[model samples]
Target: MLLAVEGLTHRYGDKTALDQFTMHLNRREIVGLLGPNGSGKSTLLRVLSTLVKPQTGRVEICGFDAGKLPEAVRSRIGVVFQTPTLDPLLTVEENLLIFGSFFGISGRALHERVRHLMQQFGILDRRTDFAKTLSGGLRRRAEIARALLHEPQLLIFDEPTSGLDPAARDDFWKAIEELREKRSTAILISTHLFDEAERCDSLILLHRGLRVAEGTPAELKATIGGQIVELVAKKPEAALETLRAKFGAAIELSDGILRVEAKDAHQMIPSLVEALPGEVLSVGLHQPTLADVFRKVTA
Candidate 1:
């Protein structure tokens, strides 16, 4: 196991940030900490990265206890924070070399490692450019390369693609996939984006500092099995009551929209339209998605 966390709990004053969270990851596995902001994803990442001591629970990384052997754990894991870390004044190659030096790597070894990582992340062509001169996507790639300079077995990313265009985000993920295949590194990333969560091998969904759900994307979506029928009603409250009477508790109202879950949702559309008459403004039917699953589990 590359990473293992059990009964992890933390607090800030009176507010709890994480509660009895437990999960594990292995080499070559991509695990996502899926949640919205303030969902304890960042807290958990801090604890695992050995920056924050866990008030309770055990965090073991690559056979090293995070609390007891933080230095050891730190040496074996790389962290890419949510915010940019590169020095704007330094060139890309210079930034990597400086970070590598901090890890006690220097001279020919550091130079070789920086070169390899730049090439691997497709930032070799931009090495001579100052950090401030690179685009958002190129800067991000440099940061990831810097994190891997020491070749850590596990990589921890906190909202890695938080501020990038769609194309840059896609490119970032492709690099991550290639890294896993080539280095067999274990990745534990925190992300709120549904598309990014869908790409993970498995996901642990957190909501308000609690573990709401945990499984593969397919498994989580399966929990909301069948189809989801959504419609905006002219009279939302009245339509909700009407739909509830006909569809039971499966019918719910959110944001002035009526949602119904059923095995044969398409067949129910006509019935729903007839029941509401002119009350429904529009209707849509689709299979379950990560967003739907999150809404259901959090609801």
Candidate 2:
């Protein structure tokens, strides 16, 4: 395992941040940490990056015990925090140089590494531009370039695309895919965006600081089974009872919406419309998606 965590738990006074969270990551894989706000994603990243110590747990990164040898673990991991860390006043190349120096890289070797990263990230032409003058997309690329200067075994990102526009987000993901292909670096990124999560090789879904589910996007969606039927009705609870009674369907009713799973939802929709009559305001049927799976698991 490139990374392994077991029985990881953390607390802030009376509130629990992580409850027996456990996960394993392999080399050359991108794993996404997924959850809503306050689900312990940030806390988990902090612990893994050695920024915050867990109250109880075992963590191993790149064959080194994270809890006992934090420095060794740190040396093997690169972290891009949720907030931008680049110095706005520094030029793009200068920023990379500063970050590289922190890893004891210097002289001709550091310059060569910096040039390689700049070229690889396609920011070589912008090397002399101040960080503040670059667009959001370019700055994000620079941040990633800086993080890779040390060539760490694992790279962790915390909502790295938080404020990026759609085009910028896509560009960032392209860079991520390139990293995987070129360096074979194991990646673990946290994000609330469902589309971003879908790009991951696998996902760990968290709820209230505990892992509720884990799988590839396809595997996770498959758990919902067949097709998903969503209905907006005047009386959701009543519609839920009717649907369950008539079709023996597994139903979920919340917030004026009723959802059920069926093998042939298209055939069943007509029957539903007939049975519900005027109660159903709208109906939709589709195959399960990551967003749907997340909703079901976290509900």
Candidate 3:
């Protein structure tokens, strides 16, 4: 294991942030921490990256105990926070140079490393541009480039694609995939986006400061074992109660829509429609997705 978290627990005043959370992370695998807001994803990242110490538990990164040997753990991991850390006044190359210096990287070696990383991120052409002038996507690429300057073994990103448009998000993920192939480094990213979570090799689903489930996306979705039925109904609450009572279905009202998980849902759809009659405005059935899996586990 490249990373091991054992019985980690953290609390803030009256509320618990992490409750005996534990997991193992393999080298070169992309593991996503998937959760809604306030799910302890950020707290876990903070603990893993040594920004904050957990009240209890052990975190070993690259064989170094994070609590006792933070410097060693810090040397082997790169972190990209949800907020950009680039100085707006500095050019892309300057920002990378400053970050490289923190790792005692200087002179010709730093230059070559910066050049290589810039090329890898497709931002070599933008190296001379001030960070404030770059678009959101370009700035994100620059942030990633800076993070890789030291060639850390583990890279951590917290909602790296947040606030990006579809095209920018696509570009950012392409860069991540390219880096994964080129570096063969372990990656851990926290995200609430289903599309982003689906790209990970494994997932840890968190809810209200506890780990709810963990598996590959396909494996997690397989736990549902059938189709997901979503109904936009005129009276979703009533429909949900009626359906759950009549069919004993696993159902709920989310975003004013009735959602259900059923075996062979396509075959049962007609009956559901017939039974609901005028209550349902529209219905949709599909294979269980990461979103469905999240709902099932979190619920």
**Candidate 2 C-alpha lDDT tens digits along 1-299:** 79999999999999999999899998889999989889899899999999887689888899998878999998889999977788999999999998899899999999999998888667899999999999877887788788888988899998888767776676678777877888888999998888888889999999999999999998999897789888899888888898889878577886777877777777778888888989989999899898888888888
Q: Tens digit of lDDT per residue, candidate 1, span 19-116?
A: 99899999999998877778888899999999999899988999989999999998889999978889999999999999999889989999999998
Q: What's the CA error at residue 9 for candidate 3, in Å?
A: 0.2
Model 3, 1-299: lDDT tens digits are: 78999999999998898999999887778999988888899899999999997679989999999999999999999999988789999999999999999999999999999998888667899999999999877888888778878888888999887766776677667766766788777899998888889899999999998999999989999999988888898887888888888778677788897877778878778878887988879999899999888877777
Give me the candidate number with maximum lDDT.
Answer: 1
Report RMSD for candidate 1: 2.0
C-alpha lDDT score of every prediction, in listed order: 0.89, 0.88, 0.87
Model 1 alpha-carbon drift over 4 Å, by segment: 165-167
By descending TM-score, how would the candidates be arranged?
3, 1, 2
Each prediction's Cα RMSD? 2.0, 2.6, 1.9
Question: What residue runs in model 3 are displaced by over 4 Å at the alpha carbon?
Answer: 164-183
Task: Record all residue pairs in model 2 with backbone atoms less than 3 Å apart, i.e. clashing.
Answer: none
Candidate closer to the true structure by lDDT (higher is better), 1 or 3 = 1
What TM-score would every model get versus the actual structure?
0.91, 0.87, 0.93
Model 2 clashes, total count: 0
